[model samples]
Target: MIIDCHNHVLATALPPGHDRFVREMRAPGHRRAGRLPAYRPATDEDWVGLEGDLDPIDPGTLVDDHVSAGVDRATVLAVAPSTYTAYGERGTIDLGRVTDVDGPLEVAKSNDYIASLTRRHPELIGMSAVNPKFRGVEWARDELTRAVGELGLQGLKLYPMYDHYAPADRDLAFPIYERAVELGIGVMVHMGTSSAKDTVLDYGRPGALDEVARHFPDLPLLVCHAGFPWVDECLAMVARHDNTYLDISMFATKSTQRQLYEFLLRARQLGCPLSRICWGTDYPGGGKPAVLLPKLTLVNDVADPGAPISRLDVANMVGGNWARFAGLTDWSEQETLEQLEAWEPRWRDS
Candidate 1:
C-alpha cells in the first residue's frame, strides 16, 4: 500500500539532433531549459551503475528498487517539454527545430510508452501529460481522452511552467480540466520552481491553483512538491480546497523532512486533515530508494509524543492515505506492513 504518487521515466532515446539543438540553446549568455546546473551528459559508467545512480534502466529494475525500498505501488508520469515552450523559448523551441516542428508527436510517444509500462506492470500506475499550449485545445482534449479512455491511464499531469502556460489560464486549460472531471480521474499540477531555464517561475506558485480548484471543486487535484519554497501558501490552498492534495515529492532530504514535519504540525493546528497530504519522491530527483527511504523513515523516528504527527501519521504518509486518495480499494495498512516486512528483511518489526 506504499503508493509513490509521483515519479518520471526517462525517454528511451534523445530526440534526433537534440544534441545539436541543445548546443545551440547553450550559446554563451543565453539561458536554456536544458541547461540546469545538475545536468550531466550520459556515459557508459552511468549506464552500468543503473542500480546505484540515476541512469535510465528497465521498468523491471525500477519495480525491484521500489520493492527493496518497501514500496508496493508507484505512479509514473509522462512529460512533454515541447508543450512548455513556444518556438522562441527553451523547452519546446529546440525540440521543434530538431523534430521538424512535430514535437507534439514526441509527447504522444512518451505518453504511449508510459501507458505500455503500466499495462505491463500493474504495480506502476501511469499518468498522462499533454501540453495544451503546444497542441490546440481540441487536440489537447482529444489526447487526454485517448490517454484516459483508450490508454487507461489513471490520472493526468500538467506542467504549466515547463509548458509556459499559467495554471490560472482558464481559457487555455479549462477544457482539459473539464474533461478530467468528466473522466473521474485526478490531475497533478507541477507547482514551484522548475529546473527549466527562464521558464515562468510565477506560474508555479501554489496560489495559482486556487482559481482552478474553485472552478472545478469536484476534480481531485494534486500540488506536486508541496509547492516547495511557497509551502505556507500551499498549505492554505490545501486547507481551502477539499479536493486539493499536497505531495511531499522532492522533499526527501533530512532538512526538508523537518520542514515538512513542522508544516504538517502547523496544518493540524489549523484543522487541516492529515489525509490531504501524500508522499512522493519525484523519483530521479529525490534519488534512489536507498537514498530516499531513510529520509522518509526519519518522520517515523521523530514523531514527538504529544505532537500532531504520530507514528500512524508516518504510516499513512508513506502509503495508506495515498491508497484511499487514489481510489485503490485493495490496500490494507496492516496487510501492507506485513507484506513489506516479508519482502524487506531489513525493515524493523513495527
Candidate 2:
C-alpha cells in the first residue's frame, strides 16, 4: 500500500473573536503559548496546486486524490505552529499562541476534530502534537496517552527547536521521551532547519538527536526532512542506529533535486539500506501531490533507474515505514520485480 507519511490538517474551531480565517500572516516568532499561527486554511491556490477544482481537505476528496495518485493511505499531523515556534531575540515569539483559544478545552476540541476525521477515513492515520515546554512532562504524558490510547492516534509529533528545546538535551525532553517509550508511542521530531525566526541552526542538526537516541535506544525516532542541511549526517545516523530513520519531506524542491540525487547515490554506495529512507510530502508546505509527484519520480529515477522505487515505496516512505517503526502492521506490500524492466521505455517517453 502507498502512504503519505507526512501531511497536516487544520483545526476546525476558530478562537473566539478571531476571524474564521487568517488574513495577515504573522512574523515567524511573535507570540508564545496559544498564539500560534493557524493553517492558512484552504485557498483557491491550494486547490489549484492539487490539480483539483475543489479543496482536498475533505476525506472523500483526499481519498479520491490519493487513489488517483496511486496512494492507498496517508498519515496526518495537526498543524500547530506553536509546537515548532521558537524564541526570537526581540522577545519570546511562539506558534503556541495560535493554540491560545482561552483554554486546554479548545486544544482538545481541535485535536478531536482531526481524530474524528481519521475515524471517518481509515486510510488517514492520525498524529497528535505535543509541546513539552508548554505542558510539563506529566501533563504531556497524560495528553499523549489520551491521544493514543483513547483517541487512537498512532504517534506524537514534536518540534523541539521551535519549542525552544534541544533534541539532545535530556533535561528538557527526556521525560516526554520516557513517557512515550513507556506508552509505546512513536515520536517524530522535526530536525534540520527551524521554521522560527530565532532558531539556532546547530540545535536542529541530526547529531543533536544522538543523545536522545542513545538515551532511549528502543524508542522509534523519525528525523523529518532527512535533517536537510545535514543529509549525510542523517544518513550516517541511520546507518549507525537501529531505531533511527529519515523522512524525505520538503526536500523535493527544484533547488535540492541534484543534491538529493547525489546524496542517495552516495548513501547507497556507502551501504545504507533503502528501507531506512521513507517518503513525505510535507504537504501544505511542500506543495500538493501534483507538484511533489514529479520530484519524487525524479529522485526514484536517478536512484534506481529501471525498477526505481515503486509507488508502494512511496507509500511506505509516506506512512508505512513510519507505521512499522511505530509498531503498527496493518499494511501490505506490492509485487517485487527481479529487475526494473520498465525504466528505459518510461525514461525515454518522459
Candidate 3:
C-alpha cells in the first residue's frame, strides 16, 4: 500500500506560548532564509504576505487528506523539540522561565497522543519519540521500553540536529538504539538543516549515520528527507550499508521535482537498489499530498530522454519497497480500494 512513512499529527495546542516555534518554522523564508535565495525574507511584507492558507491541523483532517489522496496507511511521527533545548545537555533549562522546562513530559504527552490516535485509527501507526539524554542512559532505556512495551509504538524517531549532536554519538544514544534493535523497530534520523532556533546544521550530515548503521548492522536505519543537500552522501550510505534506507519526504515536491528525479536516476545508475528507497510526504511540513503526489507520480513515471525508469521501479519507490522494509503484511493500495468498496460505499468510485 501507499504508506506514508513520515507524518506528524499537528498539535492544535502547544504548552502555553510554544506555538511560536511551530510558527517560526512554518513562516515563509524562516526555514530557508540563509539557504535558498527565493525563500530569503527581506521585509515585513515579504514575511507577512507569505502566510498562506491557515488550515486546521488535526489527526482526523490529516487522515481524511490521506484517504482522499489515495494513501492507504500513514505513520504518524511525533516530535519533541523541547528535548534538545530543555531536557538535554545541548542547553540549560530554566525551571522558572517560560518555554524553558518539561521537555520529558512534553515528549511523553506527544507520544501518548499518537498512541491514543493510533489505537482508534487502524490506518495510523505511531512512532515513539525519545531523547537519549533524558535523565541518563538507564532512564532512556526504561522510557523506550515503556514507549514500545506500554505505549504500543512501532517505530522510533530521532533528531540529533536539534540536540546539536552527531547521529553516531553512541556514548549518549547507544542504549536507546540497542533497545530499538531488540524491539525490532526502525529508527528514522532527521538529516539536513532544521528551522529550529537551536538546531545545528552540521549535526545533520547524513554520514553521521554511517557509524550508527555500522554498529547496529541489522537495525533498520531510515535517513529522512533523502539528506536534502547531502543527497549524494545519503545515496552512498544506502549503497554501502545493507540496512540503510532513504525516504523521499520533503523532497517529493513540485519545486524539487527535477532535483529529486535526477537524484533517483543517479541513485539507480550508482547501483543503489530501488528497494532501499521509501516514500514519505513529511506531511504538514510537506503540505497536502494532493499537491505533491502528482509531482511525485511524474517523477516516478517520466524518463530522462531515452533513460526511462521501469513501471516496477516506480511502483517499488512509491510503496512496494516500504512494505518490504517496514515488514508490513498483506498491504496493497488496490486491495485497500477493494475493501473500501465493501465498507465505504460512497468511496467505491473514488
Q: What is the TM-score of each candidate against the true structure?
A: 0.79, 0.72, 0.81
**Worst 10-residue lDDT window, candidate 3:** 91-100
lDDT of 1 by residue, 72-132 (tens): 7888887753623332322212222222223343544656777777887888998888777
lDDT tens digits, residue span 1-350, model 2? 55677876543223321111221112222222224334543343333332321122455555666555545677777542232232211111112333233433344344455577788788888887765665566676677778788888888878776567777766658887888898887788888874434456677898888878888899988888888878778888877777888887876542355566676666676565667677777765455665554455545656544645555554455455766876778655442111113332443353
lDDT of each: 0.68, 0.61, 0.68
Backbone clash total, candidate 2: 22
Instruction: Give the per-residue lDDT of model 3 (tens digit) for 159-236.
Output: 778755567777877877898899888888899766656567988889988888899998998899888878888888
Off by over 4 Å in 2: 11-64, 79-105, 108-110, 198-200, 254-259, 297-300, 303-320, 335-350
Error of 1 at 224 (Å): 0.0
**What value of lDDT does candidate 2 attain over all alpha carbons?**
0.61
RMSD to truth, every model:
6.6, 8.3, 6.1
TM-score of 1: 0.79
Using TM-score as the yardstick, the better of models 1 and 2 is 1
